[model samples]
Target: MKVDASAGGSSQERSAAKASDPTSADAADDAGAKPRAALQDELEKLDERLKKLYEPIEKIFEEKLKPGLAKLPTQAQIDAARAREGEAARAREAEPSRADLQPSRTTAQP
Candidate 1:
């Protein structure tokens, strides 16, 4: 907040100044719009800059990520792999290995 200088400045002097100039009211109204117009232009420029920042990320997702995602395995293939691994584990658990039947004794010679 500012204290307007009262020295040599009064309402009577201000009213007389406004009375002498008819266009001052219109100029005041235009002064208000100048800041709004400048603010609107600044907002538009910021919007354009923000959109430019996202363009490269959007392009990368479309060109690189989408194709790599398509090449990945489907749900059905992943489930089938589960069954194959479970069957191999069962076979290994049920059978005794030939290496287990032939015992080898090795002595480390230091």
Candidate 2:
């Protein structure tokens, strides 16, 4: 935007003017930034507090639950087993079941 020197010419020269301009959206953002920064600082403090609170619980889980988790089959192992079973299951689906293959006992008269 071209402006006369009386209206503050360059962008760098207009920084103070824009900050003070209540009609400008930049002014509202500038006004809101201080509180947003304060809120960000407060949230960081709360996060640190929660991190301290959960530290012991996380350690206990790592010690206790982790051993049990290690004993369980890995996801890859589980997936391989499922894949093997899937082939068998598909074959079973294609073939008639044992009951369907058996002869019916009812004798019919012609």
Candidate 3:
């Protein structure tokens, strides 16, 4: 088998060219980087705009809703509500009805 030196030398030259061609690699890097940078810049601009737009609305909600919500039922009010429920239950039991209070036979047993 005859080995071709010229063919082998050309392959070595190709490898050296690939290794040394920084401009081509840098161009490729730049091509990939440009769109990513553009997207990042757009996202940052959108985030800043969103923050600016929401700030006043957030402040308004905090100022308006918080105070009104604070005025609603504390723990004491909740205990009073439970007490009222118990009183209502006792009143219903004590009250008399014209109709029979017994469950019908057609209903399923508990």
Candidate 4:
């Protein structure tokens, strides 16, 4: 049965319509209860499973990898190395082009 959208009635009207419709009422009731609980339980299980799966990876990064990475050059050292490389690149660009050193060939008149 079609609902009166213009009436602006309470939700009771919608529920009443649903109650009268045996197929819809049963479907609505089923949707409201067991499936929702089951979905929540499934989500909780998945969350726990994901946590369990990542625990070892987290531990490896925290315990094994972090210390090794900590021993590497500090940020200041890295910035200094980058600055030296940039200076070298600028010096190379400032040098005279090799083509400028070559002798020019003059065209002969016929």
Candidate 5:
């Protein structure tokens, strides 16, 4: 019990020492300011980098990708493929298998 009391008393003293020191407040303020300033600088750098990077990608999409997709598959090509598929389905249906015409036979069970 006495050991526990001393341990608690030391923690209270440590906190009191920190609260009494003016340099501790300055340290906390410096720590907070440094990270926020670094983050603001990084954010500005990333903003400029992303803007430069996206401009070429936007040009490639508008100039190349859009024109390529427009040239693919006219109306005549689609109609021809559909007509060929219809003829193949008709041919397969005209020839029915002999097994398909057979009837099932089952015995009665107890």
Candidate 6:
């Protein structure tokens, strides 16, 4: 196969000439800038959409969940309940055994 080096060289020269031309560079920049601007506009729109989507959820948390959470028992309430349970347990332990309440089977019958 015959390789045409001159054709490749001419194409490289054309590319270099295109790059060196200010008008061609400006056109290229304009071409790239359009898509970049569109992408940036799309990103800004998506950001607004995301904010809109999360706003209701954030409001629900603030209005409903926060108040519900606030109504829940505090650490002090939990500690008080635990103290009452402990006291009840101690009272149960202090009470007489079942055997103490029952009559002795070893007692003689008349």
Best by lDDT: 2
Q: List the residue pairs that clash in candidate 3.
A: none
Each model's TM-score? 0.38, 0.42, 0.46, 0.46, 0.42, 0.47
What tens digits encode model 6's per-residue C-alpha lDDT throughout 15-109? 66666665676557956788989999999999999999999999999999999999999999999999999999999999999999998999988
* Model 2: residues with Cα > 4 Å off, grouped in runs: 1-27, 75-110
State each model's CA lDDT, in order. Answer: 0.83, 0.87, 0.80, 0.84, 0.81, 0.86
Angstrom error at residue 6, model 4: 20
Q: Write the per-residue lDDT of candidate 3 for residues 1-110, one digit (tens) a residue.
A: 98644347688775565555655575458565888889999999999999999999989889998888898999999999999999999998888764666656688769
**Candidate with more favorable, higher lDDT: 2 or 6:** 2
Clashes of 4: 0
- Clash list (residue pairs), candidate 4: none
Tell me the spans in candidate 5 whose CA falls farther than 4 Å from its real position. 1-30, 73-110
Which candidate leads the pack in TM-score? 6
Off by over 4 Å in 1: 1-40, 74-80, 95-110
Per-residue lDDT tens digits of candidate 1, residues 2-100? 653323488887666665554678556756588889999999999999999999999999999999999999999999999999999999999998988
lDDT string, candidate 5, 1-110, tens digits: 33533236678776765655646775568566989899999999999999999999999999999899898988999999999999999998898877787765565768
- Give the lDDT of residue 58 in candidate 6: 100
**Following a full C-alpha superposition, what root-mean-square deviation does model 6 have from the true structure?**
6.5
Candidate 4 per-residue C-alpha lDDT over 1-110 given as tens digits, one digit per residue, 9 for 90 to 100: 77663246778877666666656856568666987899999999999999999999999999999999999999999999999999999998999878777766676769
Worst 10 residues of 2 by lDDT: 1-10
